[model samples]
Target: MLIGEVARHSGVSTRMLRHYDSLGLVRPTGRTVGGYRQYTTEDIRRIFHVESLRSLGLSLRQVGRALQDPAFTPSALVGDLIRQTEERLRREQELLDRLRAVEHSAPTGWQDVLRIVELLHGLNSSSAARRQQTVLTSAEEMPVSTDMLAAAVLSESDPNVAGALRWALARAGGDGIARVAAGLSSANGDIRQRAVLALAEISGDEANAVLAEALENPDAAVRRHAALAVGGRGDTAAVPVLVGMVVEGANDVDAAEVLGSLAVDATLATPIMHALAGELTAHPADPAVRIRLAQALAEMPGTIALAELRRLATDPDPAVSLIAAALAGVLEERAED
Candidate 1:
């Protein structure tokens, strides 16, 4: 077959076939009387082989080496191609995300688009200060989409930058609650904690609902954080976890305070008291646990907590007795007033 016929059959363009010939990648096997290039069946087969390698993302040089070098093993080259393809995909995905963020911002002009782009770049910067400044300035100067803020909140490792992102997300209202909520299911424990922290900062039914869901998270820290946030919101659902926190001495003071606040509701007072008393009973041998529980009781309203405090005042452990006695004295003095 002549070069044109070879090109037609193989789907390799004539110019490309000539280029391949010049590079010795697939030289014509013969020539006609007019001196035009002519291809044998084997030459056409090589053209198809080159096209096949190109489809796998092989550069022309790599393709040539692959076909010509008898010792060239494909394993390393294939692995390198896989990594390169993955990197390209990652870049494309990032570009798509940026475009979506910009589109969601609803830019009125090129300036708005540029500003949004710059803000996004800053948010993704390696410098925590730049990320924090971007969030702070964007809130006042331009409207950032809740999606971007929520994403930043979830990924931010720097405490300062994370706080700014959370503040901006909270100010953005409940719009980003679902995105932040999705982070709760991440297999990463840190991400789940971050998700709960962000949810705590956001107010509204949506955030509260997500917080309630987070209360059951498998992670103990996530559960504790969610409990504190939801308890402060006056949700009695956090009672069990709050009680647990006091027993475990994990932020026991805050847990106790939230419980006391919940106890303000007349209906919750008795159960809250009983839950504390139950923990005390369950851990009788553990004086440290008992002492933390005794301290938590002081936050409860009504005579029940005072009665519990009075009983603990005579406890076996001197340290427990001393702390409980001090708390009991304070409660009695309050009763007198």
Candidate 2:
């Protein structure tokens, strides 16, 4: 095949084939009567091979080495290509996300676009202070998109920054609850905790509903935090977990306090009292459990809690008796006033 015929058949341009020839990548094996480059079957096959390698993201130099160097292995180069492609994809995805955030912000001018971009960069800064400052300044400068705030709060690890983000999310509340709810389903425990923390700060019914769902989360910390938040909202559904918290001694003091507050409701008071009393029955031998139960009884209100404390005051365990005696005396003193 002549040069033109080779270009036509191989789908490579004549100019590129000449360039390949100059690079010693492919050369015609024969000469025509007019001294034109005439390619043989073998040369045409090598041209196809070079094009195929190029399609796999191999550089021209890499293609030459692949074709000529017997020692040049494809495995290592292919691995590198895969890594390079992954990095490029990650960068592209990040850019797409930034563009979407900017687009969602609905910037009115190039200045608005610039400000949103700068604010986003600051929110993602490595320094916690910078992220916090960005959140603090966001409201004064302009309304940040809720999704952006949600993303920051969900992934933020720094306590101060996370608090600032959560506050901003609450103040900026549109779809914030829904976005944080997505974080509830994340595989990362820390992310889920952050999500619940943010949800707890948000005040609407939607946020409360998400907190209710989080009470059943597999992570103990998530469940505890959710229970505290929900119980604070006077959701009677949190009573069981709050009681379990008292039994397990996980934030038992705060859990006990919340349970006491829940007992203000007539419907929940007896059940809460029974749940606390039942824990003592379930673990009669554990003095530590008994002591914790006694302490919990002190936080509850009304004649029922007073009577339970009086009963516990005479218990077999001296520590339980002493604490219960002290708590009963305090309740008796308060009741007298």
Candidate 3:
């Protein structure tokens, strides 16, 4: 076959075939009387081989080595190609994700598109400062999509960046609550924790509802955080968990404070007093537990807490009695105020 016929048959363009011949990648096997290049069956087969290698991302030089060198091993080259392809795929997937985020933002024009893209890039940046700046700067410019904030918060590992992202999410409004809530169900423990923390900062009924669910989570840390958040909102349901935290001495001080706040409601005051009294009764032998409970009891307002503190004041353990007596005196003075 002549060059044109070979090009037609192989789908390789004539110019490329000539270029291949010039590079000695594929030379014509013969020439006609007019001295035009001619290709034999062997030459056409080589062209197909070159095209085959090129399809696998082989450069022309590599293709020449692959076709001509009997010593060339494809295993290394094939492995390299696989790595390169995987890298390309990762880049492409990231691009697709950015595009989806931009689409989710419902950008009104090129400016919105660019802003969203920049924010997405910054969120994925290696620098925690850049990520934090992205969220703060973009927030000042326009409303960030909740999905973007949700994703950033879930993946954020740096303490400062995570805090800023939470603040940004809170400022971005409740739009991302569902997305953050979805993270609560993630199999990753860190992700679930992040979800609960983010939810704690979000001010909405939906966020509160999700935090309510988290209060029963099997993860003790998750449950504790959820309880604290719910208790802050004055939900009585958190009383038991807050009470438990006092007994276990885990953030017991803060838990007691929240319980005290809950006790401000007249209706909650009695139950709050009862719950602490019950803990004291259940763990009478545990003086350390009693000491924490004694402090917690003092956080409550009204005469019930004062009476409980007085009863604890005469306890047999000197340390427990000492702390209880001190708290009772403080409450007695406060009652006068």
Candidate 4:
């Protein structure tokens, strides 16, 4: 049966069905070919269990857990959960009793009535806030946020955005990285790219296999996202991937950015030196790529970096000439050291 039929047969509103879905309560037995939920008789019975529990003042959360292990019949879980339920009921009863007390007394003035109304509204708002918080806290325990990556990616291209994203990744508390991993091959290009970047930033908790596999992604953007995310970790595990990105230049622009990020670590000199040598020796097929390559080389200091700079000095582009000279000065300082 469809959701509407389930709602009618189960005497639970479609709204409650959606809420149940959100809470991992009763899922549809299957979906129709067109994607409408098709519920089984078993599904309807589960829906009633949820409704009966709710009627008993048990939270939907309580009902969801009960459905998880129906046969276990643990007195302890029931006792603890029922006690917590009683606490909520007692709080509600206290408010009702206060309201009754207020109603039993006559309001002496318009000001008194207004004050009473304000008190009632405040109580309702507080109660609603508590309910929402409970839902959020319980949902958070599941460790999967539908928008965890988007939350990390939005709002700014720099500073505020980057700071917020870094904080989110560094502080992420979930076994739910699978959500992003699942989105890696989404039909939408942007979603795929965003997940790639997220997985990259979250590289430490992530499996090494995921990172290694991402290096082979067909999309250059995704590949770079992986490279930058790993490089951001400053983990030596990422060194090999970064080295691979250096040689895999689908274009020189992205590879240069990767090296620039690598240069943020002084210990990365060895890998950056190797990449610079490869680019200088192979000679980039694009003039712009050649320029970015020279820029990355100019940013590093060493015999390899110096030799690459000296080679670029003879390039026809004047920009390359200027950068080579700057790299020479860096090499001269190395001699003086």
Full candidate order by lDDT, most accurate first? 1, 3, 2, 4
Clashes of each: 0, 0, 0, 0
- Per-residue CA lDDT of candidate 3, range 206-288, in tens? 88998998999988888999999999998999999999999999999999999999999898998888889999999979999
lDDT values, one for every candidate: 0.92, 0.90, 0.91, 0.60
Candidate number with the higher lDDT (1 or 3): 1
| Residue ranges of candidate 2 with Cα displaced over 4 Å | 1-15, 28-48
Tens digits of per-residue lDDT for model 4, 1-337:
9888877877789897888887789888777889877887788788887888777666776677776875756477668768988898999986775555355435677676555544444323435453233323323442212243233343123344344443454456444366566656667677667667656655355634565567667766676677666555554455555545555554345555556666666777776677566755676555555666666675554444777777777777777777777777787788789
Across 208-238, the per-residue lDDT of candidate 1 in tens digits comes to: 9889988898999999999999999999999
Give me the overall lDDT of model 2.
0.90
**TM-score of every candidate:** 0.89, 0.89, 0.74, 0.45
TM value for model 2: 0.89
**What is the model-wide C-alpha lDDT for candidate 3?**
0.91
User: Against the true structure, whose lDDT is highest?
Assistant: 1
Candidate 2 residue-wise lDDT, 80-145, digit = tens: 999999999999988998998899888889999999899889988999998899899887876789
Residue pairs in steric clash, candidate 2? none
lDDT pick, better of 1 and 4: 1
